[model samples]
Target chain A: MRPIRAKLTQLMIFGVLLSMLAGCSYLNPKPLKPWDRDVLARPEMQLDADSMEDLMDTKIYFSKEASRGGANIGGGGCGCN
Target chain B: MQLKQTGRLGPALAAATCTLLSGQGAQAAETEQVDVTSLQYREVDRVNVDEEVIALKRKGKDEKRFSLKLYHDTITGASPNGAYFPSDTYTSPSGSSYSSTLAPITDERYAVSADWEREDSRRQKTQYGLAYSIELDYDSLGANWSRSRDSQNRMRTYSYGYGFNYDVIHAEGGNPVGLAPATDTTRSNQDNKLLFDFLGGVSQVLNRQGVFQLNYGLSLSNGYLSDPYKFISIDNDAVVDNLLYEKRPDTRLGHSLYARVIYNIDDNVLKGSYRYYIDDWGILSHTLDMRYRYKLNNDFYLQPHFRHYSQRAADFYSIVFYDAPAASTYEYASADYRLGNLDSLTLGLQAGTRIGKRTDLSLRYEILRQTDRLGEFPSLNASILQLSFRYTAK
Candidate 1:
């Protein structure tokens, strides 16, 4: 348990450091080209490719698991779990 | 409620279609999008849920959109009665077997929600929403608001949201009396619970083919947080059976941080995410999920997903409270497996393709395996299958 906690702490710190580096990278400008944006324009490229599917998956996970996160908002509660 | 919502959708769709067609001569402005989905969820020798959801969104000319959703669920199955493994025979209050005999329970749920969004400017958007859900013994009403902003170059984005949920919980036979040396209590009035959630995040495009997002979220809940129907076995050593009602703290605070990355290479897209969650109740969890989507062609794709999750038990979780005071075992305690230590893994595959210009179809199948701490119970095996269709009225 201690090792896992230590690893997670290190990972979190690394993630924060990486985020800082990325923030500095913003100074340089390299906009995506129209051709590059073609794939981005596709529905599949969107963060939530299928909103309804994502929502249903969230519900399933919530019911089965003890943890929930990385989604928009929480709605309803049930004893079904 | 289902019939009314279904009826309303027909007129709403017709009106939107009429509006779009009427303006076709001017410019083809897409004004509406509709999504309908159905899901079937099943667990081995356990519960099953069939759900249907319909969502409608209308985009106005002034950078504003209105969205509505109708959801219905039918649940049927036998759930654990919180007792230990059966040696002879045990029965529940509903006259069903509390152990391996398996008596089924049936219930239904309905939910409705509406939201409004306005793009305040080219780089900013704001949304507000309200929702309500109802079941036989529970009712919930909630509201939420969110805002997002994009950087000038579109390389970075930030978002924040807050939501509140008010729930009224009614035990079928009223609240249980004592926690230890369990005693019978009279039926009590409805109890309530409140939840508040706050979340903020940043989405960054690491490069042309890669993007990632990180988010921090907090949830605070208060009020009657115990499950009314759950019971804890007090004396496993004795042949005579004794079940004590469960009790939990009135307030809980939870925090979680998550990161996700999506990268595209050639004809494949890889998605990965990790989430770490902790709560005041001494439960900690880590989840890792990964997926790879392969494009078969312009109109078709296949994706394979894998997820691994592990969690520690809550501070007060216990399986059997032996020889406790007749009144209660402790201040906060539960036998619910969900609060106990466990690990689970999921493997799944999804195939989808465009049926035509306006319709698309997708199918998915997954298998999950979960193992608990005590190893007294068999590893739970669950399988899920989903079929979905999306249609656009052009």
Candidate 2:
């Protein structure tokens, strides 16, 4: 029963991802021209503008919790846990 | 007249905007940056940590960049030893009995990482990184490589990466054999493990006001997965009768899916992300995080952040075993509270302002609380404070 549920959950996640990908084209029929990207070019719009903060948070949580990953990879493991 | 040259000015303006949007203008010059960050973490009556990190980055002409980071931290505290509460005498399998109590621990860790990246004319970027960390009893070395490609319109990006880590652990005193009597210490003091991680991700610009990202990660680890210092007690009518060292399966496989969305409205930004994680050890988790940046003025802003995380227990997690299962029969078990069902939440606020044309400074504070679902372990509370400074030279 657990295996089945796990598989279903994986499928659901993949389904959501695929649907979101498909919706992307529908949401923006035409990609914004270069002149129209002023808002997107803002410093706050960068995905990892707070890289240092995210790094600290990830390390703290990884040491205290059982679940990890999904932000970025390759930081390495520690014995703090 | 200047006003009559509108036709020529229009094309020139379009070209300049294109250069900026494509990131070509920023790479036209070389720049160096330095960042320093300090963090303090405290858990109520438990562990406390002070950490500092410094990073140096240089972006050269031709879209090449190099970065180096140095990290140092000190941890001191008392941690649960996985025994039942009330400190009762427990008999060992070898006909000896002893009482158990929490132990105080102190340690310091130092780590360093370096990374290099280069982007080509085709809008493809490749990155390579190496990292090493050392503690009093543990050491780790890791390396990774990743590549990302952007669509011609510069509105979409696809990325993939692979990472490898090797770790060595040397427990203080001596490592206890799994499921052996707590008094018996005949096991090897050193053990090692290896980890491999793979990730694939995509980022899309939904519109001028929003962007979205999705990532999937898989991790595989093997060898010596159990904590060497923890043990579980056998309960005889809720009183401790015997103690045995904890044991766990030597291999683990984990999967995670994450999605994030960022939107801007009137110069204020809102960001939210969700993550789902599952592992072969019967642990499942969900995480939700949100942050909103409110622009107070052109140079100062305040942001509030919230994160919630919940996880199911591992299959073999138990607080106390009524009857201790034999090693041959059970194969794996642990009493670590981290492997138990639990929920955690974090609330934080951050304020930042530009100190000068080339300097930025930010401060943040957060509080976190964790609750055990089975009500066996005590609730954990912690607070975090961080300050960051950055300077850029062009």
Query: What TM-score quantifies how close candidate 1 is to the native fold?
Result: 0.85
TM-score of each: 0.85, 0.88
Interface RMSD of 1: 2.8
Compose the digit string of candidate 1's lDDT tens values, residues A1-81: 646765675576567647645754663447666567666566666788857767887888787777766557745565454
lDDT of 1 by residue, B1-394 (tens): 1233334345655565465445542334456666777777778888887887777666766767777777778889876656564443544333323232234577788888888888999999999999898888888899999999988877778899999989988767675643643456655678889989998888877766777788888889898888776667666455326767778788888878888888888958888888888777767899998889899998999999898999998877765556645434377777777778889899999999987787888888889888775554446788877777777764
- In candidate 2, how many clashes are counted? 0
TM-score of chain A for the candidates in order shown: 0.56, 0.72
Clashes by residue pair, model 2: none
TM-score of chain A of 2: 0.72
